[model samples]
Target: MSHSQPDTISAALARGRLGISSVVSFVIAAAAPLTVVAGGATTGYAVTGVTGIPLAYLVVAVVLALFAVGYVAMSRRIINAGAFYTYVSRGLGRPAGAGAAMVALLAYNAMQIGLYGGAGAVLAQFLDGYGVDAPWWVWALVAWAVVAVLGVLRIDLNGRVLAVVLIAECVVALVFDAVMVSHPADGGVSFDTLAPSHVFAAGIGAALVTAITGFVGFEGTVVFSEETRDPRRTIAWATYIALAVTGLLYGFSAWAMSVATGPDRIVEAARADGTDLIFTLVSPHLTDSVITVARVLFITSLFAALLSFHHTVARYLFALGRERVLPPAFGRTSRRTGAPKIGSLVQSGLAAAVLIAYALAEADPIVHLFFWVTVTGGLGVLILMTLTSVAVVGFFARIVHAEGLWRSTIAPNVAAVALGGILAITLGEFDTLLGVAPDSPLRWAFPASYGVAGLLGIVWALILRATRPHVYDAIGLGADRDTTALRTPDLVRHPA
Candidate 1:
């Protein structure tokens, strides 16, 4: 391929097809509000033994918003689909950045594969209602096929589908909240759930971590910056919009559920009906039709989440490949669709392999595949966020930006400290979160794997620096080369 031809292919990502709203839609869909409210809220109540789950969501929102201060600040100056990988490289150097890149790939891929488990389990349940019998992995494979198709299409098309699902998810959640408020139980719409003492009471650490998990996709807004219109403003606005919308929706629904069950009895109620808590509460206030619709939407919620993560993971792989950190072929884009076709296929294949492995092993899809993988994925993401926060401070500290102190220094440092604390708490309480024995191998394996992956990335980066200086220079393509050009550092060495 000629140099310009390769550069043209590298830069192809269906640019200008997405705006702020589209970016928000993708991020919000990734969060999957309906799934969180239906299942996650119940888990939060059971684990925390507190009525202040809403307050926990608010706390996480605030912490992440602070993190976004520096994140968006950097996004404006450095545009790349690599996200944390690119940010860390520019701020922390190529080796550390490469480590972050590998960790991100693991974190996002885990989340995507984990969603397949959840989707398959839920689809089987839906099918069971109609007397259609099949293994959960069968349903999982079907959804995997759908996501693979969408992942290789133009992103704007995917954004449209996600927007529809996201809007429906929000509507159902809001209606449920309204029903709870109108039919408040003995507690009568109490404000006690918002109390600091209540929020920080027993099991607060677990509650806070779960709440943090709910906001995972907010920071992902910048991943689409390359395709978005007016990226600087669009990325910033989308971040704030996604965070505020997700926080309010989650907080309102959780607090309302507590009121529906009576604050003091919410934990017991959630324990009795863990997965069906939301449906159970809503069914009483609405007609049977509403219940059926909610059930169908619940499955769609999982599908939307799976699809959203599929695109994110594909882009991460594409960015790494473009940098020559992975096989160069993985960087190839489709000329017609301007999609990262190879990366998308790779992600789909990986998901298929994992699904097949779980099926052959006869693993419990929900527990072993969904719960175990997502919790581990969430931990990896938290670690990545923490590192990115540190990189933000490092990046800005050395540069001669005229930005304010808060965005450049204080907010990133504070976010780093806050995330570090959360990461520690999560590790300490890992077994509790996974409902496993204290000595379980899973308790150690997940965190250890991420550590090993990061180390390997660092080692590979060092080797590249020593033996392939040209490739090393292109690791992140530096700040001078417009990331939009999509040319990797190694591309310079093999110019046609």
Candidate 2:
């Protein structure tokens, strides 16, 4: 009875209650299939034309798979909530990890807060359709409130909510794909869409960049590793599964959409119809009621994405806090649900501030708030992933593990180079991606913010090293522990 008491107390404080399925749901929710289809696919068509969009997804998938080979290997050794920050630290050093952590905090928060602009815009439109008109920011605040509530609850509860939304999203997409496939437009189902030469005919670089952005949230599998049932196996399996599912689903849907609209006309249709192109094609077959259902599902999909990202940002804060890199208050979890209560509240505060500022400035939600911020966030993630791949190679090169040559060295290097090239192209064509002028400061400003954040992170680490050596020792290596030693006031904060 005495031994069991400690176990119960530990369980209540450190909540690692998530499993493989729950982890998968969190990642998929972050990807937000409906948003990808509605936004990414439409943009891909407008930028690269039809034949190349599917191919772009396939290529990015292969590169990320190579990246994951080393990523999963490191996850087994260093289990922490910091994700890229932890992996980079394991491979590089604590300062570099701290830099990555700053990047991650900025990237994840940018991504999450950016989604509010989209959710508000979409929800406002959905409400408008039902004769309930309101300002976009008002709708955004509604979602903010709901997500804030969910973020403070148990993670398993969030998982269940995401699972239901994810299922509805998948169902609607599959049904749409089936309808499109069964009634392929004039040219009929053509394998021509899958041809490499055809896929790159319009523009290879643009298509590849857009496609990679669609897979943004897959790397987040490791963020939940501490909460998962089995960190090593769960992280590895979830990473692979999330990547495969996202790539296949995205590739298949783009192809079906092209076929539904006729390959030759897809670009024109996308340019003309935007996100409504696919809905228009499928609307002819499905009942009128299905349209309303899909629109509702679309709103829920954005909400799920918001909640998933909120949890991700909160966890990052929680991990950093536990290391004394940030305030230790963020490290506190609820005894009842094991949720990072303080971290969740912190994230919510940030989101509210951003939303309020944007509203005050009267910024255009879609253009200024959503696309501008999300595109920046996506670029930051790419940079982090590229660095992580390099870190992986560096880590495995020294450490003698049984994982073999391919997993340790070769794959990581190749992924890093490929990703580096993509990053260069993305920068070169920044104006085109942002739909802005060649000299737009917004183009340079967003990417520059990341560099500033990284420099700040490095400085902060050096300060910690000089002032508090003990706290500096545990930067990216922070994880929950029961030991009384090292449990300083600056370190782990236990639940009361």
Candidate 3:
């Protein structure tokens, strides 16, 4: 407990700070339920012209729940902030782990920065109603500053902020759903959109991918395992709870919107009103003040997601740094708050740079920055989940464990095939998801960047193996600096 040993304190996250509810809040806020329903779902309807969005949400939820069965099972044995990176390394090999690490950093950074575009645009429009005009980047910078400050504070403090915003966002969204359902269009309460047949239709790939993006943040439950109290139970419960809540909310709300607009006209309304479709639906039924409040919550919903993703990206960097995959400086933390100080600042700096670059080019915030970038980030997460599912089987194959066949072998194998198929479908529909021409290079370019990152990481891991063997040996062993020897043993492990 001596304050003199700064290295010991700085290398570790603040332990025993987060509980089940706080962890759930962090995961769900990252999903940004309100933003996904208002922005993502509407975009799905407009861009893909798919009415089966509700079914897509439920489908992805089940797929991820299967993914989580093995995911949380692994979390009990290995506690690391690197999450996917560590799991892949321990289960696969060091080189693959390194590749997964870089992919994760790139993906999470894309996701965190992409939110600035949506948050900035929404905030700017909100202020425009008050006759205070400013560019979207200006509002984005303001949000950037706030998230940057909070990123360096205690992990639980960030969780508390997210919990409050997330609760209000969900409440408002539910109210809107109730109002919309009660005032159905002429067809009156049709459940056609929720049908399974619609899931296999022509544009179903795009709709499924869009729904997958909405659940992108649920896997982040393991990203916080290092800081949670009783991570074994806490992480498992939080993962399931977050998935169930977001999935149910998204599916119910999407169905309600269809009920309000009528199944046939839902796509038309989405195209006309865009993200404003939800508010427009409720406007005739509710007062102006309530609508205004919902709009403000929309902005806050984006902000909450921004903070959550920032934390996720920062922790990934911290894990890499702690393992010496990156410079040791990236691993350092603030002793007082136990936050990943250097990693947090680095992510914030990267986000600011991207914002400035986009602003300089006068890019469309909603289209180019938010929609394209976030969809690509979702693609990265999809890739990681597929890889991690495979890794789960590998990891269990090498060990003696008490976990049942369902948790260790059967579920992971099924999830791997399911997610792998989804990944293929998503890649095929990337153009549709981006609302671009099939011949457009942007579709290939965005997905290819992840390949480049993975390749570079693999090369770097090889370099480390030759030039710096110790660091390479510790590639996925975050905070457990002395466990390198145990890694080679056929060990019987127990839950933490």
Cα lDDT computed for each candidate against the true fold: 0.82, 0.81, 0.90
| Ranking 1 against 2 by lDDT, winner | 1
How well is each residue in 450-483 modelled by candidate 1, as lDDT tens digits? 9999999999999998998877877765323444
lDDT value for model 3: 0.90
The digit string of per-residue lDDT tens for model 3 on 1-496 reads 3456465357789999999999999999999999999988997888888889999999999999999999999998888899999999888888998999889999999888998999999899889989999999999999999999999999998899899999999999999999999999974789989998986787777888889889989999999998988999999999999999999999999999999999999999999998899999999999999999999999999999999999999999999988888987788889899999999999999999999999999999988898888878888998999999999998888887899999999999999999999888888888888889999998799999999999999999999999999888777777676756355443223111
Each prediction's RMSD over C-alphas, in Å, is 3.8, 5.0, 2.5
Clashing pairs in 1: 474-489
Model 2, residue 3: distance off in Å is: 21
TM-score against native, each model:
0.93, 0.91, 0.96
Candidate 3, backbone clash total: 0
Instruction: Point out the higher-scoring one by TM-score: 1 or 3.
Output: 3
Best by TM-score, which number? 3
Off by over 4 Å in 3: 1-9, 483-496
Candidate 2: pairs in clash: none
**Candidates ranked by TM-score, best first?**
3, 1, 2
